[model samples]
Structures are given as C-alpha cells and as structure tokens.
Target chain A: MTETAVTRPTEIEWHGVSPKYIAVDLIGTAVSALIFTAAATVPYWLIQEPWALIPSAAVLLVHLVVLVLTPRRIRSIRYALRADDLLVRRGIMFTRLVAVPYGRMQLVDVNRGPIARAFGLSELKFVTAAASSNILLPGLPAEEADDLRDRLVALAESRRTGL
Target chain B: MTEPLPPRSDTQRPEEREGLGSPLTEGRGADLAGPLPAGNPRTEGAGFEAQQPQPLQSLATAPLTTSLADGEWHRLHPATPLLRGGIALIAIVGFLITNLRDRFIEGFLPMYRDEDYSGDPVEFLVGEGLLFWALLATLGVVLVVVFFFWLSWRFHTFRITAEIVEVRQGVLMRTNRRARLDRIQGVHIQRPFFARLFGAAKLEIEQAGDDANVQLSYLRGHEADALRRDVLALASGAQRAAAAAAPAAPNGVPGLVEARVQELLAPELDPAEAAAESVVRITPGRLIGSVLLSSGTLSVLAVLAGLGIVSLVTGEPIAVFGALPALLGLGTYLVNRITSGLRYSVAGTRDGLRVGYGLLSTTNDTLPPGRVHSVQLSQGLLWRPFGWWAIRVNRASRSSTNAQQQQTRSLVLPVGTLDDAVRVLELMLPGFDAATVQRAAAAKGGEPDDPFTNSPRRARVLRWFSRRRNGFALLPDVVALRRGWLWRELVLVPLPRVQSVAIRRGPLLRALRLAGVHVHTVAGPISSAIGALDDADAQRFFDEVATGAVRAAGNDSSHRWRSAEAAS
Candidate 1:
C-alpha cells in the first residue's frame, strides 16, 4: 500500500532579534581605535610634526565615521524564515536580499561572546555546504536564538525523515 | 500427501528470498553447503526435522574459531618531511636576519669613519666587541639548525585507515585530525621540480571540513598516483553505496560522484581529429612577432640590457650572460609561442566543443556542458583591429588551488574571434544562448551594464608638478581597454580580485563631488588602482557589490547536490 503524504504545520518562523547589537559594534570599534592609537603613538612621537598628524587625524576621523555609521546600519537589519528558505534583508540606502534554502544548510553554530553574554544576546551562524560562505544572524536574544536553532534542526530532521 | 504446513508467507521468510536476490548466492551458498554434508546423521535419523531450527541456529551451533585477521589498515603518507623543510626554511631565514643584524653592528660600524668613536659609546662598543659577537652569532645559527632537525624527527605522524585518514602533528600544541574516507572530494598529486627529482609527490586531499584541505608530505611518484586512485575509488564507492541504499536522491547530489565524473570528462571531439579543423593558422613570422611584442618578452630584454650595462661598467665577465637564466626566459617564451601556435585548433563534436593549445608543456583542458561556473570574454584596444577576444571559464573544483593549476594547463586560445568565444561558451554553459552573448558583446558603448563602468561618481584629479606644472597625476589610473574589431570593447580596472573596498575622498575630489574607491582582491605583482568616481555613485556601486557579495555568501551551495533530495 502506498503511503499518503502527511500535512505538517509550518515549522519555520522568524523571531525578533536582540537590541544589544550597537554595544557589540561600539566595542569592536573602540578596540580597533585603541590598537590604531597605540600603533600611531610611536610615529607621532618620532615625527612630532603637524604634517605627520594630518594622516593620523584623517584615519581617526574615518574610523569614527565608520563606528557611527555601523549602528545606524544595524538598525535597519531584519531576517525572516519561510518553510523552505531563510531570508535576511539589511542596508538603508541600498537594500540587500539574501535567501538561503534549508536543504543546503550544513550546520547551525550558536556563539556567545563576552559582550554578547553581558548583554544577554547570542549570535546564530548558519553554515551552508559551501566552504566559503556563512550567514550570521547577530544580536539575537540568548533563549530565543537557542529555540530558533532547535526548531531549525528539528525541521531539518523531519525533512530528512520524508515527513 | 501429508497436510503441507501452510506455506510460509513471503514477509515472514526473508532467508528464502536472500539467496534469490543476491548474485553471490551461487558461489557463497556452495561454500556454506559444502562444509555440511547433505546427509547428516541427525537429519537422516529424524527422517523429517521435527521442526525447522530457529533462524538463529547458525549462530548458536557454529563453532567459534578465533584467529586474528592478517591485514592491517593502510596509513596515509607522512607530511613530516614537508613540514620540517618549511620549518627549517623559516629558521634559516631567522638565523640570517639575526646574523645580518650582528654583522651590521660588528663588521660595518668599525669601518664607518663618519661616526666619532669618542663621543658615541655605542660606536666604541661596536668597534671593540666585534669579534666576541661574531663567534657567539655563529654558534647560535648552528644551534637553531640542529634544533629544527630534532623537532622534525620528534613530532611527525600520519596514518590512513580503512575508514579515515589521520594526522597527528605539532610539538608544543599537538593536534590530531581525522577525515572520513567518505568526505574526501579529490586527491591532488603535485610534484615540483625538486620533488620530481627526488621521486616524491605531495598529496593533497580536499575534504569538507574546517581545515578545507589535508596534505600528505611526500610519497613515491607512482605510489602517490596509486594512493590517489585508491582513495578516489573508495570515496566514490562509499558514495555510490549510500545512494544505492537510498535511490530517491536528486541527480546532482553527493551520491552522484560517478555521474559527475562522467559528465565532466565526457569526450566530445577527439583532439587528433580536431587538429585538422583549425581555420586560422599561425605563421613563423607571426609567432616571432607575437613573442617580440609581448610585454613579458619586452621586460626580459630591458632587464638584460640593464644588466649588460652594469657588467660593462663593473668590468665583470660578460660571458655570464650566456648562462641558464637568460636562455631559459627567452627559450621558454619562444617554445611556448610555437606550441601555442601548433595547438591552435577548435572543433565541435556531439559531446561538446574542444579547444586545445600549448607548446613545450602541451595541455588539454576539457569542459563539458552544464559544468561551467561562469564565462568571460575579454578584448583590448590593440586586439580591436584584429577582431579577437579571449575567453575564460571558471569551473568548480574540490581543491581551489588544484583547479587553478588545471586552468593554467593551457592558454586555451591566445586569440579567437568574438564568435569563437561565444561558440565555446555555448557548449560550456548550455543555457547560455549565443544570441544573448553576442548581444551583450555588441552593447558595449553608452551606459554599459558592466559593474566597472566609468560613472559621473568617479573623481577626475590631475596632479600638477609642484602645484604649477600642467601634467596628469603621476599616479596614473591604468585602465586597460580592449575593443575587438568585430565585437565589443572590454575595460579592465586592473584592481586585482578585490579582497576589500575602501572609499576615500581628498579635499579636491570632495570639492569636485567625486571620490576615490579602492577595490582590493588579492594583490599580485601589479599595484591595485583607486578608481575615481562620483562620491554617491561610487558609494552606491560599492554598496551594491557588497550586498551582492553578502547574498552570494548566504547561498553557498558549492558542495550542494541535487541528488540529496533523491537519497533522502
């Protein structure tokens, strides 16, 4: 006897992300700036000239601008999951659409950095079969990210069982 | 007849069908039955077995014989020699650097008359303690070399098992890594000049893991090839067995290794027959002219002239010019051109199209339809008059480096018409319509769809000598533009592969509503360019490419197989 197809409820869903993404970005920027400042100190002290200062000042200004711009950019980021694919859209002026099919997913890695832990958020990195590319959903709430990861894993397993 | 026991249902009698389904049943069943005589005393006395013994009777009645199996699992090639060599090279360089520092302080300081020794205690120390430092430095170099050799001996271990290949390495922080046989994509055997002379080839296995690639240091040339074939067979066999077990998978999925191999290497046109299909033949004069006109040849000549002048002034022996380096460069170039000319043949066949070209190191690279990743046609200003375009294909390989090596196997064609390029692309990418490609080639002018198009967003800044001289900037934005006589023109920014992109604007460009954008891929011998563009447009393009990159990153299906579905 042929088995009939079973009707399963929608398994994939999108939950809202954590709000501490700004903090992570700021920390990364500050660390970068600190390293740059340290590296520049030697040359700055050696040259002791206004001309040398121009280059350093320009670099610092660029870094500051990037640091400021990142948070604003993060504010526009959003993600969604349909039955078959995951979608991520971000960018203010130039919109980007990224869709990842579930069948292609290799593994899901959930990571929590020191800052992320302090802020009670986690990051979900979905690695596809391709060696070079990974889709990272950052600034996710710790419990929420874990739950979503479990759901995705379960869906993948169910799909494997011909459900 | 005695009431026949109800015939056992097919569902309950799996053992009866087992022999019927298996091809090995005849041979294996004979072996099993031969040991047990057909007329057993116990069975004959019973006349009819009171009841058929339980299916598990074989296990319960079989005598236990324990003898250790003789065959040991095969081991992977040891990577120690290569690792040691690399470590030694690093150590030697480090030693040389330290020696150079010591020599500068001890040997050069005393000879320098410009420094006043009485005023400078540092100079005095260098002059007096030169001998002491030299002896100590020599000892240090010897010790470092000895230590490296010692470490090489202590820390290398590699083993290939039936199911996995294992590597155990590192001295202080030991790392043990294992790659399952089923996960191995392909084994690449590489033999550099020295390695070939030593009869050793390096084996690299591309696997789907964090390390990406695993390398075996050295194996005998023939042995390496044998090992490669064995590994490939095992991997493919396992894949096939898995697929056979679950036959519903998609066609392109993991289990279709055999299918992929067939599709990739299928022969369309025989190279021997296609040799006669060449329409455009290269004359000796053209070959010579091409060699002379090439940038590589010109650079070699320039270097030779510079070296000749230096030798003349220095009164060094000019006979040294006849040595191997000078001859190799010129000889290889000439031979390369001639071979390229000889192999200039493109022909179509049922399987696909074939283009073979090369000289001293002749190479034939086959591309089957539907396997091509991307195709690009390039033309330059000089080639515009001749109406020629160069075609290139990007194909996926398990090992990126090996794929690159294979791509360099031959310059498929030095020069071909735009139509020829389209013809080749059509076969390589089946869905790529010739008409569409031709249309894209023809629509070159106006606002081209090329991502590198010159836009109003680009900054046009000319550097003035001393801020007074009316000369273009010394930092020339080298844009290589090529227009085929028959087809479209291609503009190359020569920006390398663009690893990162940085947007910068100087006061002048900022005032002019322009910005300088630097796209960094991989830095080769050539310097990357900063394309001057309108600030907004440059930013927009940069953002778009970045977004595209993100999208591409999200959909990495490099190892995805259509067959996964079928198997599942």
Candidate 2:
C-alpha cells in the first residue's frame, strides 16, 4: 500500500561523503590562490601599481577563508539513495536538494580526477533528461562510488522494467 | 535501500547487472548475447525469429524485444545520412581546415624570423602555388566526411513489429532503441525545405520516456507517410486493447471520453485531418505587438538610452558607439521573432494538438494527449494593455541541441487572446476545460477567492518588485501561479507534472511570517512557482499539491500497481 516514488527528505537518510573531501578542497583552493597570487605579482612589478597589492592581499584572505570553511563545506555535502530515487544535498550557504528518481536517470557517470584519485575518492554524476536536473555527488570513497553506480543502474533497470 | 520488487535473478553479479542493465546497450546485449533461455522465456526451444506468441507485449513487461528471427537489416533511405546529420559533419571538417591553416601560419611565425625559416608561410604557400595542395587537403576532408555519411546511412536501420517500433544506428557506440507501441504519444513526419526538394521526410515517433522515442529521417516522402500511418494504426490497436482492459467508468460519458482520448491519440495523418479545426491564429498585429511588448526589447532600449546618457555626460560623441553590438543584437532578435512568428498557427487534430509555425525553417509539431508537462500563459508588460497571452508548454522532449530551439519549440501559441490560451491549455489538459482555464486566468489577483489565494501584505515587501502581481489559483488538477508585475508571468503547473514541492522559508521570509512555495518540474525554460505567500497558506498549498500528485500518480504507476501479484 505504501509503495511509489514519494520523495520525502525525512524518510531518506543521507550519509556524509568521505572526510578527505576537505583536503581536496583545500588543495584546490591553495593551488588556485597560489597561481592568482603569482600572476598578480607580474602587474605589481611591471607598473608598481598600488592596485596590484589588493589582489595578492585578497588571495591571502581567500586562502584563509577557504582553509577555515573547507571542513564545514565538506560536512554539508551529503547524498542518499532511496528505493526509487537518488538524493543529493549540497552547498553550505545556498542549500540545494536535487532528488533524481531512478526511472528518470539517463546516465550515471563516475569521474575520477587526479586530486580525487590521490584521495581515493570519486564524484558520481547523475544525469536526468532535464538539462538542469543533473546531480553531482563529489568525494565519495572510490569503492562506495562504484557500488552506488552499479546499484543505481540496477535499480533504474528494475524500475523501468514492465513500463 | 529496500527494493520494492524482490530479486528476479538471485545469482546475478554486479558486473552482470552492469552489462545487462545499461539502458543504452541493454537491447543489443539481449540479442547479441545469443538469446539466453532465461531472459527469452518465449523462445524456449522455439525458433528465435518468431515474434507472435501473444500480441500484447506492453513494452511494460518485456522491454528488450529481440531482433527478428530472420536477422534481416532494414537500412534507411540512402540519402538519410547525408540529409539529416551530414551538415554537422561537414561543419566540423570545415572548422578543422580553417583552424589548421591558422595554426600552421602561427607556428611558422615564431620560426620565420629565425634561421630555420626564410619567409612568411602564408606567402610562401600561395606564391609557390601550394594552393592546389590545400585544395587537395580540402577534398580529402570532404571524402572523409562522405565516407562517414556513407557509414552512418549504412548502419541506420529501423524495424516495425506489432509490439514495438525500433531504429538502430550508431557508427561506434551502436544503439538499438525500441519504442513500445502502447506508449506512443504522437508521430510526426517532417520535411524541411531542402528535404522536401529531395522528396524525403523524417518520421518522429515520440514515445513516453525521453530515451525511448525513435526519429527516422531521410525516407522517401511517400514511404515516410505510409510508415507514419502504419505506426499510428499499430499504436491505436494497442491502445484499443488497453481501453478494453480498463474498468468501466462510473459514468457512461467518462467511458466515451476515454475511448475518444485514444482516438485523438492516434489520428490518421490524412489530408483531410490536415485541414481539421483551425483553433487559433497569430494575426500580424498581435505578432508585432508581442514582439514590441517583449521585455527583451524594452531592456535593449533601456541600455541604449543609458549609453546615450553616458555619451552626453562624457561629451565624447563616439562613446555612443559602445551601443552598436546591443543595437545589432536587438535588431537580429527582432528579425528572428518576426520570421518565426510570421505564420504561427495551432490546429486541433483528431488525436491531440498540432502547432505549426516558422518562416525560414518551419516546424510542424504534434503533441498527443498527456505529453505536455506544464503550460505557462504569460503576458509581458506591454501585452497587459492589449490582453495578449503567450502560451508555452514544457513539451515532451528529452534534449535539445540548443536552449534557443527549446524555447521556440515549446511555444504552442506564441501570442493570443485570453480565450486562445484557454483553448490551447484545455487541449493539452483535457480534464481542465476552456471554462475552467478562462475563469482561472481572469480571476482576481488579491484575496482568497474560490479559485485564488493571494499573498498577504507582509509577503508583498518580500515579493519586492512583483508585489502587485502575486497570487495563485487551485484547480482540481492544476495550480495556477501569478507573479511578476513588470514582466507578468502566469505559470500553470499540472499536478501530475509536479516532480517535487517544498515550502521554503529563508531567514528574511521566516522573520516576516512569510514562506515561499517552490514547485520543481522537469527542467525547462519556465521555472513555475509563486514566492512570498503567507506561511500558513504556503503549508496548505504544499499539502494540496501533494494530495493532487499522489491521487494522479496512481493513474500512471507504470501499471505496476495494477499488475502486482496481489492485484486482481
């Protein structure tokens, strides 16, 4: 009697992704900030423009903010797989909960970048027919990622069966 | 996670599931795996090609219908590859040639002044009569494209059976797609200007799911027409069986309507039906008015005025030239709209709705019943005075090559009177008739009427810009939302199409005792929802939408509930 794709957040239990995601974000922010700081020095040295210091100083401030916020940001990212749908809740400030029903999922992509691979983590991307309904679950343990991908594919197939 | 349905294959491994369950390759795998006896229960000790065991394979129970026993391949009309997807291939090759030329010249530029090179590569090539080699390269590129087109055409094939209609073609990642006849919503045979010259037409067999539809292009126009008829006939036959299987309705009229729905769903593409009821037309005056009334045009004018003011203040007359691109862009947009909306017309076909419009590249789209996810009857700022509604729907399309095409194609009626919008809406949502839609549209925007529940004044400050025009009307099956004063948009979200609904209360809204109702639908251009309604009203709205969705969801449980073992 209680069967169907009823997307209730309360019923769907979400699990936090691998904590190494904090390290991943920190590394990413550090690298990008380092590059920006280096590039900002060129204009500063060439023109001795007081404005150039603003960029380098801004980069340091950004790095500090990223370092402080990375753990909390990582903590806020969670994903859940219900019987009939995949749920992803992300973003620290502007929370977004995208629930992609299993029947609606067209593609399941498990992408592993260099940094992710180094951390033994992967991002699972769920592509639905709707262009904007794609959900990305970043920083899941590699084994869990593959497991989720296979489970989703199987679930989608079974749900689509007899339809 | 608990699976609702118990495991059918106990011993199936993860890799096996991956191999057998991938939606794109599942059909090919079933046929290619040499017919496993367990999967193909009917083919037990029987010849593989025999399709007729029992006629009603709803594509519900058995999705991957094996290839015919004969293994006969039905290729597309020879020119299909060249006509349909050839331009994209040719464009890529042209882009590569131009990119190569520029790259070669740029690479030599660094070395031209060094000891390794004496002169400019461009001059040397042209001066040395190397243009012939470039021409040869171009010819080689064209040949490669021709070879690909040939391969594409060679691989492209389609087969029609009683159960499903399938089109299989892909050069590298081969796709074997099957469209279940029962799920067939609409079929269109389209011929573009050039394709018409070639006497070729494309058959679009739109089905239920985004992935399941079949588009077979470049068939002989006559053959395409015949094939379209055959598909519709087969689909109708299946639907007829379903209608019989469906229980008798409480009222005799509902039963008749059910049969009529099926009839409308499978209208014959005959010449007579082509001249069916002409429901609405976009007159020249309306077209021009809508174009001028477009918020986009006013914004362009505003930007232009701002640029003029800046130029005057700076006393640099040439500074006004910064507005050139904006002017040119606005002009181009106006031309495109005029061209496209020149002959916009919506006609009622036997099965559903047929909307045809466009001047340069005309598209004749047919939407069978239950295809539209939602509809929006919007009136731009200027159109408010004239009382023109631009009716757009989130039509049944999986993907579009470009966002612009999505907007253009979703327009069933670009601009019309209030009655026209109602007519089109009722056509899409038959249960909600013209009177219902008319009343819904003309309802008062403030206070709680029978149909409408307006936002409270506390929420108005939260609505901010769209303070005046914010309200919602609740019908049995649809929830109509009115928002935006400057660019007034009337959004109608069909209950069944409402994928997700949530009552959002941000810090500001919560403090103001106001909450926002957010309705999520399949992603499209229109984001339909009203924000900053009274908090208590928002909760009530959420419960009502949920009830509507659950009640309607039963109708399309994908026949799961009906076919469950415990059911009759």
Per-prediction DockQ scores? 0.08, 0.07
Name the runs in model 1 displaced over 4 angstroms: A1-16, A38-60, A63-67, A93-96, A105-107, A127-134, A150-163, B1-371, B398-414, B442-568
Q: What TM-score does each prediction get for chain A alone?
A: 0.79, 0.86
Query: How well is each residue in B413-489 modelled by candidate 2, as lDDT tens digits?
Result: 88888988887777777777457557656444553443567777777566765654587767777788877766667
State the lDDT at B305 in candidate 2. Answer: 95
lDDT of 1 by residue, A1-163 (tens): 1101000112325444655878887887888887786676666689787676765677677789878888776775667766545555454444333454443344577899888788888898765433223367888888888888877765544322100
What docking grade applies to model 2? Answer: incorrect
Error of 2 at B429 (Å): 1.9
- Tens digits of lDDT, candidate 1, B291-363: 5555567677777787777777888866356434876878887665665555455554322344544432223
DockQ class, candidate 1:
incorrect
True contacts kept of each: 0.00, 0.05
- Native-referenced Cα lDDT, model 1: 0.45
List TM-score per model, in order.
Answer: 0.45, 0.64
